[model samples]
Target: MLRDRDNVFCFTANNLDNSLSRLTFNSCTASSIPSSTLQTPPPITYTQPGLYNVYFVSDEGLPTMQVDCKQIRVLPQPIIEINNDTLICQRDTILLVANGPNLYSALWSPVHNTIPPFDTTSIRVHPQEDYRYNVHLEFTQGGGCAYDTSVLIRVSKVFADAGPDRFVADGAYTILGGPRMSMGQEYSYVWTPPTYLSSIVKPNPTSRPLDVMAYYVTVTNDSTGCFHSDSVWVRTECTEIHLPNAFNPVSDVAVNRNFGLLNNNVVKLEYFKIFNRWGQVVFETTDTGKKWDGTQNNIELPPDNYVWIIDGYCVNGKRIKKQGTVLLTR
Candidate 1:
């Protein structure tokens, strides 16, 4: 092999008179020696590299014959494939193992804890970001030549946000789930406790719950087989006073004529008040059955937005206090 090129070069010669017998070893460090009377010269040892020439001359009694230069060429030495390039989720660990024949030493970059005598070496790696691991294997016959291989360990940063806490009226539908970060093809989503939800695999699924519920969502990377999770809550204002957001005092529809709960279930009405934009008290009452008729001091008030407040106890004996705005249309 070119790595350790050592050869013995000798010449065969025929010269009876021994008048002309010679050998010329042509190389980078050119040298020439000759033997007389058809005797072969001592073997020439080649130390360096590249093309070499062996020139020989023979002389007969008739005519002298000389041979041209003969050439020899020499060329540097050039996968202990442990594993192919791989991808994984963050915070996860994987094993990198390699087994090869006649190994003297094996080392991996981005260092890890390893034992000696690395003929067959295996190590565990956990990386946070994308990284490329380079492996160097030195064989016993390498003769100072280095053999190398590499495996790319790509880290996929995964995240899942199940949206902010939600507030929905009882029996009302609301969408769930928020943001997510993932990698690989055919990525999928999963929402836990799929009850009352329209879809479990969708990033944002509709839900209709009768009571408070907590939902969790997981985002999975199909290629890396990695996942991340987060949770959110859906609280229900299920049993309380229901106030109309808009009203028309001059409308023929009786339901749109006044502003108040359609049917009061309040066991104890603490207070009920409505204020204008300037925080002026326009309508105030404590009687649950007596609702506002869009009037103040027996005069019709102008149509505008008004803030309404309620502090009372439901028929189920649950205390409630809340405030909201309502439109007053003539």
Candidate 2:
């Protein structure tokens, strides 16, 4: 017999039953029943992986059993999980794993659209830029889906290389500029001669001219590839030395032929000397332009070659010493 106490039912059957009976209850309503028939509702199942409250009730007249209510949970979908949120210069690989069972597909997305080579579960990824990455896992069971993590990656920027420096001439002189100066960085420089120059040496060229003039300059570099140059031009004037072949020294009544002095009369005769082939002083005189008369101590001398040494002053306040060979025709 089964009796209804209020909303609960009571049943006293003589045989044990194995069939499961489905129970219905108002989620917000509460009812009292004997604890004998409903000691506790068999563990309840949930539709999703979250907490849910379950109500238990017995036959309305069953006063011998008491019922209790509790909560249950059903696990959600699968999710892809990553171990780290960042990578460094040395260690750049990212490890990934699935957080749920029955995962059929996995996908990853970068906010910046920087595609990574590895996009599946248990992926090893190395990102080259700063961005956000997300992992999406799709389960094989009934369209279940999950996301484990989103991470930000920072990639170091490689710096650009710069070239070398310039040159100047005569270590003491200033440089007008053959080649312009360059920044001190990491780069190679190849310089040809300037349009004005016709030299072979490149960036560190030697003997290059700044203009079409007779200027010469050399360009070079330091041990570490730094550039420098030196330039120079012929700065001295041309000079010449004029000499006479012979001088007359016969004191004549009509023609007192005399070599005179250096350029006419600016210098006075100091001393005159003559040397033989053996470098001996053979003849000397203080009378300006006095000829040897081809004589040695009143004896007629032979016509042999002799050397002459002349000492005089220049117009520029400089003294000059000249030595040469002269022949006595007499």
Candidate 3:
């Protein structure tokens, strides 16, 4: 029912003399002044929706009477109200849901595109700058008797950078979100793998990995939820390779028997070399995954001591070098 404004109607009685007529009119509503005793019952104002039968009766009261009746129809107009929404780390698409009809307009050119078309009560729009749609919903259901209602929708715009791909030292923590996470404020955020992040919802989070595997992050929006997302990679860089104090070079165990750096990945390896006590270079290699088997020219060297030196870089060209001794056991 449209109680927004009054539906008014006016009329004029021609060739009717007030001196010869005792005119009476009925407004056909219980709430309205039911009847008026004037020849031209000052314009009628109806506030409700429905069919109304207005009457104009002129009685001379002396065997003479005249009556006229007219019927008017009132139908409710469509109503639409849209609220302003916020986004950053911003949304690429948004859905506008409301009620109305006759939305033929060009006002949606700036907000986004219509996907899957649109119905009388809803529309889907895509990634765009910004927009304020002022449209009218006119209903002809009342046979050209329905009114038009105006609606305004303010679609906010926001942009985001998930930060840059970074390399952090193993067993150490680094903060995410390079420079800025968003261009605007007044919103919350979340990072994947809450297990590694110090605070998932914080703009910046500390990430620390303890093992040798890479962790992947994924984000999703719920059915009725709207949001935006981006991606970045964080890798572990091991500058200092691990070593054992001693190794059984001829032992049945492979990893436990190899006299070489324990790992080779992520970190940039420059050179790795091992020398005997007498300053004789027994093994040297710039290639990764190469290990010495306590052999000198294919002859297995007996129990002895060896010195090793390695040069490498990690975390953006930070130089690192180390030298140590390993006991080659029998």
TM-score of every prediction relative to native: 0.47, 0.27, 0.38
| 209-297 per-residue lDDT for model 2 (tens digits) | 32222333333233233233333332211111123344333434322232222232213335667777888887776554355554568
- In candidate 2, what residue range of length 10 has the lowest lDDT sum? 234-243
What are the C-alpha RMSDs, in order, of all predicted structures?
12.0, 25.6, 12.2
Count clashing residue pairs in model 1. 0
* Model 3 misplaced stretches (Cα beyond 4 Å): 1-6, 9-27, 30-45, 48-71, 75-122, 126-142, 147-162, 167-173, 178-203, 207-229, 235-330
lDDT of 2: 0.42
- lDDT rank order: 1, 3, 2
- Assess candidate 3 and give its lDDT: 0.57
Q: Please, what are the lDDT tens digits per residue for candidate 1 over residues 28-138?
A: 543333322335555554444456666656563446665656665532232364877888788788788765666667777756332333344677777787777677776
Global fold similarity of model 2 (TM-score): 0.27
lDDT of 3 by residue, 129-235 (tens): 44443333444565433333323334343334467777766545667665544533454566766666677776666776544333333233332243556666777
Give the worst 10-residue stretch by lDDT in candidate 1.
1-10
Q: Count clashing residue pairs in model 2.
A: 23
